[model samples]
Target: MPQERPVEDLTEADAKAELDRLAKAIAAADQAYHQNDAPDITDAEYDALKRRNRAIESRFPELKRDDSPSDSVGAAPADGFGKIRHEIRMLSLGNAFDDSDVTDFDARIRRYLGLPGDAPLTYTAEPKIDGLSLSLRYEAGVLVYAATRGDGETGEDVTANARTIAQIPQKLTGAPAVLEVRGEVYMTHAAFADLNANGPRTFANPRNAAAGSLRQLDAEITRARPLSFFAYAWGVVSEPLAATQFEALERLASFGFSVNPLTRLCLSPADLLTHYRRIEGDRPDLGYDIDGVVYKVNDLALQARLGFRATTPRWAIAHKFPAETAWTRLEAIDIQVGRTGALSPVARLAPVNVGGVLVSNATLHNEDYIAGRDSQGEPIRGGRDIRVGDWVQVYRAGDVIPKIADVDLTRRPADSTPYVFETTCPQCGSAAVREPGDSTHRCTGGLICPAQAVEKLKHFVSRNAFDIDGLGAKQIEMFFADDVLSIREPADIFTLARRDSSNLGKLKNRDGFGERSATKLFAAIEERRTIPLARLLFGLGIRHLGEVAAADLARHFGSWDALISTVDRASPAAERAVAADSAELVERARAADEGRRAELKKTRDAIWDDPPLPDGARTAWDDLIGIEGVGSVLAVSLVTTLSQPGERRSINRLIAELTEIQPPEARATQSPVAGKTVVFTGTLTRMTRAEAKARAEALGAKVAGSVSAKTDILVAGEAAGSKATKAEALGITVMDEDAWLALIGG
Candidate 1:
């Protein structure tokens, strides 16, 4: 139940560990709530957990794990119900915990639309019902089916159970031909109490009772339960409902579906927040349970343009009410070192319930937070540091581990002393150094640290990597601990069976491994001898090198040998470029004159336009940078990994073990421009730069931002610049926009 370390303080190992922990925890929570109608945590607690997970992901984007909770919605439909796939996905709303988040949401929308900050925009604010999400699909104005929002893309068919809800219309008079009305299915407090009093089973809360009742297999049971439906959204409509959100809700109401009376239109963030406050005040008097207020862009066109993330709509956000708080005694403050040596201080508290969930521990965030200071060094909690044996108030802000909000000054333990933050790693005797401008005290042990080495090794062979059948995390741990015939590195796995032949302590006789299983493990390792270039790149465990960046590099470079050559050739140049980039900011710290510093920094940043290099490294660096998705950050990571002797030696060993590195296959092999290199220069009037690049990729052609000797075709637009001249001099095909379009028969 540790809280996330600040993204700025997180290393690659910390990111992976945090992501893994959240994935498992969120999945378990989702199943309990969505599948079993038994929620372990309150809605606010759950939302906060997901929100923090996203914040961390946004910060350490390269280390997002495969099991990330953000990738999915609610758990898969409960057993015994037929599955229903939504034509248009039913997405969850992003959460806004505070007033600042609400303001930021509006700002983000304006930014995306390229509007002035004060530009008038409208949003519809409505009470976010605390109930089970239900999707009612009506074909030709007649209700065809009903489903639960199972996993966003698909759901459970509860058509029979849905028919029992009187508020849900069986047929709509003026609805779209193929309309899917989305709403919340809930029971009022009176109805819930009545059910528990007279029905066969006792219930925990209105939301749980409503979910349990709506999902019942027997229609009679659902009919007997008093349930109400509030239509506030829609999905998979055959025709356009309206131009604006307010109109759409009115349309839904016209079709016999009940829309919430609390829904209102707001002009700005202030209006939205005011409405949110009104709803919060109204919650106590409302018939049904409500957890939060949902604010959405009123213009449907803007919503479409705002689009969505993988699991949530970008235009809308749920502003959650404050979670329940409880006072607890601080038992202990433990510093747990993350994989990347991030020292996270977790507070162990006496057991207490906050927002209906049992909580024993809370994330202290960092040593700074414990010392009563924010990351900016601003005083917090009246500058009073947290201490062991002190009385503290814990609040569940949607995280698995609740956080301590305040200390009870009156109940302060007189014997308490100021807690000293650890200056050395407890796991290893290595000095944990806090670098200047860094919030974390990281162990400088690097690969020598057992904590970092073991986790990296495990990650290298994870399911997203080699995915060896017989080798799991447990087995990897055992092998890592082995002194003889040990599998210490990725390359060591390939030589394991051979090395075991000569070892006195054979792996076959080891605990949890037998002759058959050991042989199977060796076979699994052998099977992975031939891996795709992207997987190999990912398995190398280079910092800032995520799967997407790896795939981009792999497709651009094509082979392992080619990647090594590119990185090697570009290393010295990349080093110089990095130095120049650093100097851009460092110059600000030196020299007295502002004009002089600005002039000096401009030259440093212009290194990207044309870096002055000593060898083929110039072209190498340019090509590496120009390859669409292989940005300077990832390119620099690749170069830095190779620049380090230890990392390069390890990579060389792995490369030696691999039999084959599969080449990238083009998306459209049959396309006329397949496998061709194309560059578009100057102002493109026919399409956007992104559109042109996407089209080229779809045609199996490579799109380079800058022209080079590798450029097979250069599509010259209005006032084609120096790139066109260079392409022509290189004897590369230089075509105008019309010629370029005709070549692909556009």
Candidate 2:
């Protein structure tokens, strides 16, 4: 037999040629999968091809084409719909298969922005529908045209058909001169069934059903199809509408378009996951089909900075849910340890298709998962038991990594036997221990554990922590593995700058970085040596001492030395005095009062009924309580966390390095419109009502929910509503949104 060609050995030229070939093939496949709804290959096979192409391209960047197969849109435009040019292009999103992909996306975004690792990047998430794309255009506050996303730049025109949709307004409540909104048009499972029963032809899927309705040459036929729209994008705009995606959607609804109300705003990835879970829970109950959830960085500025790849935007990614699952043979069980030394069981399976990826393994999670088996000794509870050569169901959820979903006892091989759980760590040979409350087993090797060391190092340089430049999680793992970095403690990170770069063989050969990168990393470490006291405090990884608390500590103490002293000096009585300007403090100190000084101290501490205090103590007490948003609980946490012997020692060293650095304490500024409250009514000429509200807040004006006699100004625009009449009755001035904008000089 002929020897099989190895992909790794392919030269740059060979790789480029192969990649280009695959790109064309994949693009064709994407068109078929998305546009035609008749896939040429299964999702798993398509994913494998794409994954392989990506790997090759990553290995040889020169092989990567600008319009590679990896850059295809997931959704296709419906036929028969007319095309409309967008004012600003509506783009698609990239996808992440695992944690690594997400981290890489974040790293690139931060790098592009020239922002420090700790610089905040917020994200918003929405569901990615498996439906047809449509563009709705409004001119002079009236519905004008609706089209399909034919080729992103141009789409088919379907204006008359779109007019029949009851949810879309013929004339908006209050529309802009020229407004073009892009969203997904889909058919609900129930609606699709109803349409088929009442109409000419039955549709195969919701995507097809939506496409059929949207593409009808006759407007009446298109309107007859039970179709719904969820605005996910915009085409052209004459004026700026919203600052964020969430805000934009709200504006769409206000303009008389029926937008999906389930859209949400998530502050963090954890919160993003919460929304995903909500979608998962409601998927079956939902009327339409959703492939997965789409997440975008919430800040418009950040989104612009992130920009887009050739086909997809960098700021957004789709988290796909799994649709189909299949059974595969379980070959063996292996244990993978995490940075926290938790032993995770992995099911080694015969290569099987799940979603679009080649599934070779699945996570068992823990001992209970492995031991929970049916009467036949196969894993139960919808998961497969770890048995050698047993057939197991591998399932993928919304493009998430595949997992073992169930076991097929009927297909189990005769030679297979019940699997035995490992007693020792695979990497360190340490005894694995499972705590009573925890589901995961742990390796007792501590710092010596390779998994633990790599994980700790990764965490140390993560965006939220030290945020060392040029040190990504993968690089940290490699450096730790090569003995270039250690994970014994936080201080070890600083020592890396002193490493002998000449002797670092691994650093010389790394893909993204070389000896020059090592030098830059050293410089970055040196740069962080004199970190702000708050950052330094937060870097220590003290439990519950978040960035906010650290800033509070820094502000209250002024300097590290002051903070250390206060912590050492802090006592229960001092804490009580800080919490409450107690009366008892006055009488006891009055004995030493001179020249009626007791009265002054009482006033200073707001302790008129309490005893007198020295000027210095009063000053400290006053300074402590004066800070905004700081109260008894937080103040106590700050004092106690900094007071521990270990914490104080660590902070003392940090203080020594932070001696010259000082951050100013924040103070509440006098509001520009503090004395007067404002009420808004009717439409605004210059801005949206929401924009007016934000402006009022910025100007330090309290925006009342309704008009009252106390309303200082009411900017009423064209077609003033009942609010304007009521304001007049209450003797409150009325103004439109535009007039209000002008009044605020916005």
Query: Highest TM-score, which number?
Result: 1
- Please list the residue runs of candidate 2 whose C-alpha ends up more than 4 Å from where it truly belongs after superposition: 1-18, 33-61, 74-87, 328-746
Clash count of each predicted structure: 2, 36
TM-score for each of the candidates: 0.81, 0.44
lDDT of 1 at 260: 95
Q: For candidate 2, lDDT tens digit of each residue in 255-331?
A: 77777777788765666777887997898888788867877877776565455545567678776554578888888
Segments in model 1 whose C-alpha atoms lie over 4 Å from true places: 7-13, 60-67, 398-400, 457-541, 546-565, 582-586, 594-615, 627-633, 642-746
> Compared to the true structure, candidate 1 yields what TM-score?
0.81
